[model samples]
Target: MATTAQPVAAREAVFVARALCKTYRMGEVDVAALRDVNLMLHEREFVVLLGPSGSGKSTLLNILGGLDVATSGALHYRDHDLVAADDAALTLYRRQHVGFVFQFYNLLPSLTAYENVALIAEIAHDPMPPAEALARVGLEARSGHFPSQMSGGEQQRVAIARAIAKRPDVLLCDEPTGALDAATGVRVLDVLETVNRELGTTTLVITHNADIARMAHRSLHMADGRIARELVNSERVPALALSW
Candidate 1:
């Protein structure tokens, strides 16, 4: 339960994927979700993965989050080999190192925003106070409200708060703003940007919206289960500067 911030060294990669593959078996046929993918995410970097539907973005995110195991090849997070990790080790890694946010706001309907965030913090080995985490997402005033009482954007902010409350080393977001309208999505993205900048957490956001690439430190384009291109922004724009 060490809360001290560790300086991210320059030597080793945080994530290392080499010829990773994942296939799903549906009855008599096999559906290949990911094919020979190799990628790395460094510490404190904001990376956006852009891809159309059925392009294996979610599959890659799942594999990185330890929610699903790769079928072949090597997947390593720091010194730990993720592809060979057992269930217990995976659970430990997720609990200690990773945070996840999804498209839908999965907050419990009965719990207030503060309580919902506190639930996760209570279980985390080293967590920030729920109030401080909620404030980071611009939800300090709405802390007592339930998900039903909040707008879509506000609910999403609460979800972000919950994800970051653990002060995780890595944050994995899959279509975090998919359910919100343009204006609201921008606001949600603002909070995400703030989290990335202030906390120095290594963030990977997967979205189909091409405009989002403007805000990332590096943008990754995925096609047919492989990375098609990678671009580093010379001067990354803030989320508020993004146009549809």
Candidate 2:
């Protein structure tokens, strides 16, 4: 019964999408991945998108993160027009403002944790020290360890550290816990929660897990190709207390 109401003043909007659409071309036909979707993401808000497979959750997240473009619609990240941005502009936007975490921990096998994270920091305009980023994820001791030497959850934490070292304005995660066991997933989720709360990074997560929604400030349920419902959590459930 909680509405999208808060006692505090309204936060500034970071992303605004109006009448968004994305269509995929098959060998012989066109498939609509998204249909006239509308949404707004506020600064420092933790938002979750939930849906079954093929419901367009990933498509929407990809579009927002600049991994893909919408077929048509008004999509803006602050003052930048996402829908109108060229490949170079979109790439720049992602590098300068967005951090991405995927289901798989895409850590380079040859690199140590610190080195993997330093790869991003080296190119970032203003980045946190790789050691500091590792410490933020509770992996300071594992900084010299390679991916193969770490557990799945640890590797994922390293991935998260690499993403955030750039101090991005927004963090987008796609099924970040999908490949891990329940306990490991919880640990990863806690790291994400800590990052969002401590750094005030505007965060968005895509997941099929309903329990994860309880941790979000707001949840968007998707069906077919659009948002079916939106809920504002009256109270957030801590990541440690969430069950599958």
Candidate 3:
């Protein structure tokens, strides 16, 4: 029964949305992906959007991460108006402030872990060294290893390292552990939790697993293209304590 209560001075909100709507145009039909959604993501908070498949969780995450734009509504990332931003602005916003991790590892087949992370750092406004990023994810010794040589969890860790090397303000993870088993997924979640704790990145995770909600500072449930309810975990548990 945890409420959304915390230290007012330190709890700064990052993304705020009101009456958000997103629609997709088919060949001859319009499909509503998200409908009048409202949400707020706070600084340094670990939040979870939990929902069944096709419940608009991914759509909402994409919009927040700037991968997609809402059809209509007020969506703001701090002072930036996300709903009014152009393509160039959105691209720049993502590069400078947001980092993303997906279910699939999506690592470059031909590159080693170090190289994959360094490629992003090369283009970032300000970035940490690839080796340092690797170390943060506990993969320093495997920096030289190629993606094909790594396990699923190791590959996901590498992906997390690449995402955080640029030191983004927000980290958006879309089912980051979907491809791993329980043990492997826990390792990946451990890395994510560590990053949120040590770096103060506002983190949002999209998942169907209810057990994972126990690890979040606040869990928002989505249903039928809208936010159903939210629960704040005043005393959050570790990922290792969760079961399928």
Name the best candidate (by TM-score).
Answer: 2
Evaluated at residue 39, the lDDT of candidate 1 is 91
TM-score of each: 0.94, 0.96, 0.96
What local distance difference test score does each model get?
0.90, 0.93, 0.92
Per-candidate total of colliding backbone pairs: 0, 0, 0
Tens-digit lDDT string for candidate 2 (1-244): 2234232118999999999999999998999999999999998899999999999999999999999999999999999999999999999999999999999999999999999999999999999999999999999999999999999999999999999999999999999999999999999999998998899899999999999998889899999999999988878887887887
Candidate 1 RMSD to the correct structure: 4.8
Q: Give the range of the ten consecutive residues with the poorest summed lDDT in model 2.
A: 1-10
Give the range of the ten consecutive residues with the poorest summed lDDT in model 1. 1-10
Give the lDDT ranking, best first: 2, 3, 1
On residues 52-78, what C-alpha lDDT tens digit does candidate 3 reach at each position?
A: 888899999999999999999999999
C-alpha-based local distance difference test score of model 3: 0.92
**Poorly placed runs, candidate 1 (over 4 Å):** 1-12
RMSD of each: 4.8, 2.3, 2.3
Against the true structure, whose lDDT is highest? 2
